[model samples]
Target: MEQLRVTNQDREHVVEHVKAAYAEGRFDELEFEDRLERAMTARTHGDLMPIMSELYGPRGVPMPRPVPPRATPARMHTGPTESPERLAASAAHGLAAIGFPIVGPLIFLLTGGKTSPYIRQHALEALNFHLTVIGASILLPITVVGVVLLPVIWVAAFVLSIAGAVSALTEGSFRYPMTLRLVK
Candidate 1:
């Protein structure tokens, strides 16, 4: 089979994947920088395949292979006070409804996100959702129909923020609907 050429978008996709992998503690800083450089420089599918092979297995594989355990410095708590961490994560979502919007989640992300992946995930979700809401609030006012729906959007954002908080508290997983995910 002939090797397919890779475009800038393809390179960006791979770079993003590499970044996510690094964020998840799949590799160390040096390895991440190396992989990032390789992904950015890739010119063809063949070049990209090997970059992710260790993380996702072969190119045609349907699922990722298991990752062996590694000593990651990011994990801070193991037992006892874990519930407080969950509360903090839940608060990241709840703060959006109370008018903080961007600042609330950004605070949580900067404070605890660097230490705990769970907190980071929840904070980032909340941050992204609020950003999407803010963007909509700014752009939607230009159209008459949007002006009518503006209040509706605000209400939905409020209700959804509460729901997101509840989900983060109970399930540790909550994805806000209609989010832009601009941060990551």
Candidate 2:
């Protein structure tokens, strides 16, 4: 038995063909199982494409055209409404700001669902700033009162930071209240 070398593209195509053929009731159980195994083992475009072409040719199957890759957006723009991810991130930032200060609110204002590299960069910077502030408070302190206070603040910041990061990952907009307004 020859092994099928399949590219990612070819593997995808083969899977589609197998699904369609099985749906049409063209193959008996054994043959379907064999073809499915072959399709799964395919690794490269050269490998899987040929196998699919051969398998589906008898039925006059047409080859699908390759899709062009999408271009990245040049800028980030938000209108009156924002995505849920952004809102969640913003809220997390707001909550964080209560204890951690300016870092959280800044992150919320800067990062939105828009596909701008600059926005992402700023969001990261803001997150980093928040982490640094929290880290510094934990690591450095000359007074006993400051030492005791740091831990309490640290826990609050930690929770808010996690929430903010999750919101950003999910592509939601978040807003925080009572922080320095960096972006409108």
Candidate 3:
């Protein structure tokens, strides 16, 4: 058959669907990743067919997610609130501050992150932040200036981790400067 060409939107749509499935516990990490890579790289209708088919079994409409009860904040600015999701997010950065390179974010990623987008984003950010720090630590020791900057980097990471934890707890978003997103 002459295949219909796919566009970037088509590929992105498929990827989003796969992510939703993964988030909803329909697919495992390995399976999600394999499907994701294929969806992202698919070239034509033939390429897209199998992915949607496997996920929905020939259904045309995507599965609808249940509506969550909305929480309206009284003010634009809010303080730290105790929640399982927020606690997991705070731990992602707090543990990083204590010098666990991957363990902290890994914990969040494995736990609340699997289902919560909010937690997942924070975990990925923390993981990327520390990965960047570890990479810089290894490469910076070679030069005199780099050696001088090494301790500075550590201090900055320390401060940033605290900031990340606070922001995460308070329903705010925090991003590390110069972080490379290797995980996402």
Candidate 4:
């Protein structure tokens, strides 16, 4: 049995690796819990290195390389460029307007309004379409007889809006369905 050396930095790095692996669903429940426990118990970098090597070695676990940070786009020199968050918001807005308006505005607002203006603009347009559809439906005689459908539409919109909001906050690029491409 060869003893492995660990240093403080190695332990911290190992802990991070283990956490990332677990988050990526590479480990089953038992393995995940066990690995997490081991990572927590790691005291020094040297101690952690060996443990990590063992876990990731043949017949053990496989660890992936850390993801590099994405480069931030430089500020637009002219007009505004779309951000990932904004792209997602735009997508959410389109989905919401198409009878799922619930998620668009929530995503737009929750993203600290820092998302791309393009996304916000698209979402607003979608929202407008959704309102128009609801208005048209309400004015129809058959829709008046089917008043229960009104609540269903509202609920659907609310749910979609919430989803869009969360995605924006998380900086995800979501695409709205059935929306005109107003922004490139």
Report the number of the highest-TM-score candidate.
1
- What order do candidates take by lDDT, descending? 3, 1, 4, 2
Q: How far in Å is the alpha carbon of 102 misplaced in model 2?
A: 16
- Steric clash pairs (candidate 3): none
Candidate 3: worst 10 consecutive residues by lDDT? Answer: 73-82
lDDT tens digits, residue span 5-120, model 3:
89999899999889988898776799999999899888898998899988877776665555644666633334335497788888899999998968989888888888777788
Return the lDDT, model 3, position 116: 76
Model 2 scores a C-alpha lDDT of 0.54
My TM-score estimates for the predictions, one after another, are 0.60, 0.30, 0.58, 0.31
Clashes of each: 0, 17, 0, 24
Write one digit per residue (lDDT tens) for candidate 2, span 68-119. Answer: 4464342343322346545544454544556645545454446552454334
* Candidate 2, run of 10 with poorest lDDT: 175-184
Q: How accurate is candidate 4 locally (lDDT)?
A: 0.55
Better of 1 and 3 by TM-score: 1
**What number of backbone clashes does candidate 3 have, counting pairs of residues 3 or more apart or in separate chains?**
0
Which is the better candidate, 1 or 4, if ranked by TM-score? Answer: 1
Highest lDDT scorer:
3
Query: What Cα-based lDDT does every candidate model obtain?
Result: 0.84, 0.54, 0.86, 0.55
The digit string of per-residue lDDT tens for model 4 on 96-176 reads 645455465446544634545545544554455455545645664365655766666556655555555555545544443
Worst 10 residues of 4 by lDDT: 73-82
lDDT of 1 by residue, 90-178 (tens): 89988888999999999999999988777888899999999999999999999999999999999999999899888777744788988
Choose 2 or 4, whichever is better by lDDT.
4
